[model samples]
Target chain A: MNKYDKCVQYILNNQNHFYRIAYCYVKNEHDAQDVVQNTIIKALENINSLRSIGAIRTWFYRILVNESVNFINRNMKEIPYEQQSIFDTEYTTGFYQPDDELMQLVLSLPNDMRTIIILHVYEQLTLKECAAIARIPQSTAKTRYYAALRQLRTGMEDCNERK
Target chain B: MNENKDINFDKSRDAYNNMAIPSTLDDKVKEAINMSAGKKHTNNRIIITVASAAAAIVVLFIVSVNTSTAFAATLSDIPVIGNIVKVVTGRSFSEKNDNVTINVDIPQINVDSTSAPDTAHVTAEQVNAVIQKTVDDYMQEQQSVIDDYKKSFLETGGTIDEWNQRTIDLAARYEVKYQDDRYLSLYLYMYMSAFAFTQDNYYYNYDFVTGRELTLKDILGDDYINIANQSIIEQITEQVNSDSNAMYWGYHPAGYSGTDPFEDTDKFTTITDDTSFYLNADGNPVICFPKYSIAPGYMGVREFVIKRS
Candidate 1:
């Protein structure tokens, strides 16, 4: 088989890893599928720039986050949290269901804040890695993480009060 | 799931593995890759083709057709051509028939497209269609003229078919030019062909302005180089003489070369009225119009043509 066909096999082998990264951001089965497809397309476009297959996970995740944001930008109109039904149902079927109030609070933060939280809580990358992925200073990444957690805490408090 | 300060990275990794990927993720990715590659290839080809085609290409501009009124400030109440033409055709321009002085830009402009007998997007396949249509129009317009020309040629004890053969033989040029004046003034330079460059003529006297077509014999004539240029000369002269005011009264010669006396010289006298001079193409002195005397009413068309004669 040719090199590209072999690369396709390698991609299939590591798809579960790819899916985890995609699912972390999109939070829906269908949108995760779309994100995976777009990441593959981006990989092939910059395959020459893919330093190693080892880095494919990191590279594909970066593409995923970027494409997910772009997709949301186009589809997002108003921040009516009532429209997040599909997002909620998608993870309910998964192994772990996240805190709904916490999810809403995190999502309500600005994109940069949400991205930082997802990278921190879900991806669990180091602060240095997050800074590199986001192209921001390490201190800035720390600030965003703290700010997002503070907002989530406030959101949890408000929900408890309402209940 | 973590009780300790350091959550279990290995367990978390394992949990991630348990999480299912979207169905057909592999196939979807392949399809997207192929599609993106295909799109990239096509876009690159289009840019390369356009860039190559743009080199020194003299395009007959097809100006913008959105000539209807739009919002813009102009200081003039006179309603100049700009107000009439919102966007000019990027190809051909008409001074009188088209009142809109539009800035034209035609990326696909060619002399062949301009010389189309029919006013359609002329392509290679459509060449035959244009040829047939032009032939039909030629027959319609010329049957009577041909019969007359033949009748006169035959009256002197000659066969008409030989003359008919000459007229039929005009297919080589795809256009027919004449100084026909069934009515007074108003000339036409009609280019009727799905073929190569034919002579464009001048009938400066008529509002139905046209360019004449010549036989291959007329174009190549006895002097091989000039048959092509003769028709071009006739067109330049026609434009010089044509204007709205002198639409009918202007003058254009019916023929060229030493064979046709009026076309041989730049002097406009009945015997020697050659209004053209010779010049080299690098802005070297060629044909310049001497301030010659023309009838007071007929000065609009007296053009100064500079060319490598």
Candidate 2:
């Protein structure tokens, strides 16, 4: 099969995880669908540009990250500081159905930390791979991952205190 | 402490993986692939190149197609600062000899990856390609509309010179209002003055993690439509009654005989999806209705800022 066909097969097999990664950014069903669809289109078009077949996973994810960033930057707007805590409300109000308290802590992270943690811990990617997707240095990715851990620890402590 | 941290990490990892991926997504992907394959003409078509400067130091682009064109002037091999990424602003401007003008600016990503360098450039190139394609498609459609107008003008007995004398211009620019590791909001404003003055506004809000363009319903949840509609209606009524300049079509002086201000609420309710809104500097959603929708055409556009506590 051609590169496009190969890319399609890869996407089809890994679509569930792809959708989850997308869902983490968009937090909605339809928009996640749009992102995944658009990312696939983008990935197929640029498949020829890939330098190595071994790096396809990172390359595909880098596209996904870029698309997600573009989508958010394209749609960025202002919310009042008071209303900015909507993500918290989204989780607590049943808008975001986190499986448990740990999931809620994962969601509570600011976008940057949350992304790094998800990539390292959840996606099981190495710091090098996370850095590639994040378009940051490996050192920075390492820092962010550890920082996210600390934040989650603090969050868990606060939750337990409240109980 | 490290062991506890490791356990927490494992727990979070499992939680992350366990979240359900919609079963319909694979079907959607297959359908999208098929659909894209069907559209041969526009698929991966390099449409237009908006701008390219031959300067060695600064390379500026407003693109149509051709990824190679964007890289004409690349950033220095030496990465700038610690995490310095160059933001390549893609812009396209077309002014037909007849005074019909179209200007478009799209932000393109260019990163200098001093570390993990191989794929960063690749990702940047891909992003530039995708964004350029989107802008090109939008401009192509806009150009088609202008072409049709000129054709119809000739058929309707309007001389070429007369249409030329009309001096119609269209300008659209995309603004990156907010950017961070995970979120991006872009606002597009297009104004066209062909027959009468008209302007359109679009907001593309995205969550980078989810890779989705957010909408009002997504941000505000299910009850957003009713809540936002009521809030906007009340705000409009207050403004119309108190502020002399604020006037909806219902409150026009020429035919002020009898029209309830709430007469437009039914129409307002119709704005359930595809509602045009932008976030203010304070990050509040400000809903913008097109010209003549809620007010007189001359008033241009009407906007209501939704303040949520």
Q: What share of the true interface contacts does each candidate keep?
A: 0.33, 0.48
- Score each candidate by Cα lDDT: 0.42, 0.61
Q: Summarize candidate 1's per-residue lDDT along B1-309 as a digit string, tens digits.
A: 222223223444444445666556644554454444444444334433432232112121111111111111111222322222111122332231121111212112122333333222232123233333333354344334445656676898767455433312222121121222211121222321211112122221111111111223321235423533454456446653553122111233232111211222333432122222222223221222211123111122233322333
DockQ per model, Cα: 0.12, 0.17
Model 2 TM-score, all chains together: 0.41
CAPRI-style quality class for the chain A–B interface of candidate 2:
incorrect
Compute the lDDT of residue A112 as modeled in candidate 2. 84
Model 2 lDDT at residue B195: 50
Error of 1 at A69 (Å): 0.3
For model 2 chain B, give the 10-residue run with minimal summed lDDT: B48-57
Indicate which candidate wins on TM-score: 2
lDDT of 1 at B176: 21
